[model samples]
Target: MRTIIENATLILPEGILKNGFAVCTDSIISQIGEGPFGKYNDSDMVIDAKGNYVSPGFIDMHTHGAGGHDFMDNTVEAYLGAARTHARYGTTSLVPTTLTSTTEELLNTFTIYEQAKEQNTDGADFLGLHLEGPYFAYNQRGAQDPEYLRNPEPEEYNLILAHGEKHIIRWSMAPELDGALELGRLLRSKGILASLGHTDALYEEVTEAYKNGFTHVTHLYSCMSTITRRNAYRYAGAVEATYMIDDMSVEIIADGIHLPKSLLQYVCKFKSIDNIALCTDSMRAAGMPDGEYILGSRDKGQVVVVEDGVAKLPDRSAFAGSVATADRLVRTMVEVAGISLSDAIKMITRNPARILGVDKTKGSLESGKDADIVIFDSDIAVQTTIVKGKVIYTQNNNLKS
Candidate 1:
């Protein structure tokens, strides 16, 4: 049976569609256009959007967890809880990120991730795992457990490849570190996205890393390199290099607290929405009341505190993570950065989907793509979320699943 969402202001790739309707046959968007798409048969389920702005459901490529559940829990329970929490905010798909931990721990995370994907829970779909650590620059390691940080080791990586690379979609590391570039090439060859992050890599180093297949940057402008003086000489850092490299996609925490509004606008000025993804980078603290929580694995996690709308290290020297969801990210882009709704939606949808290599199936509201959609009012508040062509969440009904 076909489901028709009529009377919507569609936010399409090219522009917006006022008084439009979209047709979803099962899980794919069969058609979308402006005007009253003709009268549908009773077999077709017609849902009125009430003239809301409809967009593709957000795809978060970088996130830890939410609802007091970390993905590192090594259990299906954590995955379901976190996924459902983010889905409530319109994330139709996401990659569960891992913290710096033992090789054994990372493998377990991949195993749990595979289980979640296979189970196909009602929350946002899981693409794969984002390996955020165990390969990084120790000096720039913010909120990451320093004990687990180190340069890339081939022996360990080879073991990971042999065991869990199939479940790994992206990997973040410090490009300047020894053996890191080789690791990036290996990850690329295996079809995993190699992202630069938690580093102090210079422009030249970053260029080398990109050439070696580090095509993405994690949490741009945070824990990344920028202008710095070295023995009276000023040099552009990885941050500037990312801006200069047109094709290197980058993600921002976009919760307004992780980065100031001016900095967010500056990033927008330099990078197109095509290369910028808005990620929550949220942790277990997200969707939970403000308080102290763990940032990684249960047995040996980093203690962090949530205050003033963001997570921070216990001592307050660095930020632990974000307590934001996808809706807050979209809202910040529109209200704080003064970005247009269509362009802002692109940041959370098309851009991340493209970077994560799931665009063919997930991003955009187009014919033949996955019917993952979100409908919102003028303030960018999500009124309803449709995942895989199913209305899984709604604001008016106070429903979440």
Candidate 2:
């Protein structure tokens, strides 16, 4: 099957191409060029972009759930349900993230993920799993359940690796905790991404953690320490170290609620578009109407409320999660943070794909790359989503066969 998208503004790695066209032969992009499109087979499925922007589909690296289903729901349906929901919002690739949970529950999720992935033909492709902690610090545990938070234990983590090594892509934890650096080393040895998150680590510890292979930061500026006083002596914290370090990549939940506009702009200014990726950090409430929901497994998760476009604890003490979608994140960065449309799209598409080590064929619009594309308008509203050359979701019925 051939899919052709023409007369659109293409977001390419170098820059935007006006009146560009892309030809997808099966799942791979066969050709891409600017100006008028050349001849094609009469049987080709051609889509006129109507002056909208055609770009690489978004890649979400740290999303927990969407469409009223969390990854920790421990069901195949829940996993695929969230993936499908994200796909509708321009996420062609996603890494299903887990919250702090029991070992048994984590193993169950691993089993379910394997099952769901086999049946995930109609949703966004699952890159892998991101284990977000049973290894975080207690005070920095934002919305993560405190019951499961603790220092890394070699025995328990090693057992987890034994069972879940193949499907685990990344793991986020507090690097300051006991045995955490060793855990980072173990993850690095296995080729899994080691990330710092939910921590109170100082600059020195963060520097050491980076050297030990913790090269990424999860949900930057959230659940991380800043400057603090230790015995009347002010010390730089993890947040400061993130800026001080030149090569460390970070993901931010650019939902406009979790982070204010000024802070988002500040991050973009310092981190640059290449080093910063955008994440939703969304919960089950994503794409759902404002209401009550669970943040993890139904039986053991905490109850949270979605209101004012963000999830929050019932007491309103802190943000439980975000209800933003991939499209919303791009829109927030462009409109709220004063970022250009091209750069904002990169944060959601190219940057995350690179951070997750899938940039060789997935991040941008190029010949011989996967046909994971999204068409959106000036407002960044996702009008069509094509995954692996298949028109998975379209707003105006633009698919032929």
How well does each candidate superpose onto the true structure, as a TM-score? Answer: 0.96, 0.98
Candidate 1 whole-model C-alpha lDDT, 0 to 1: 0.88
After superposition on all C-alphas, the RMSD of every candidate to the true structure, in Å, is 2.1, 1.1
lDDT of 2 by residue, 1-401 (tens): 89999888999999999999999999999899988778778789988898899999999999999998999888999999999999999999999999998898888888999999999988899999999998998989999989988889988999899999999999999999999999999999998999999999999999999999999999999999999998999999999999999899999999998899999999988886799999999999999999899988899899999999999999999999999999999989888999899899899888888888889889999998999999998988888999999888998655543
CA deviation > 4 Å runs, candidate 2: none
* Residue-wise C-alpha lDDT for candidate 1, range 1-401, written one tens digit per residue: 68788889999988998999998899899999888889667687777788888899999998899999998878888898898888888889989999888989877777787888877658888888888988888778888888888888899899988888888899899999899989999988889999999999999999999999999999998888899999999999999999999999999999999889999999999987789889999999888899999987677787899999999898998888999999899899999999988888999999888888898998899999999998888877788888888877876542211
Model 2 residue 74 CA deviation (Å) reads 0.9
Best by lDDT: 2
Deviation from truth (RMSD, Å), model 1: 2.1
Candidates in order have lDDT scores of 0.88, 0.92
| Candidate 1 wrongly placed segments (more than 4 Å) | 396-401
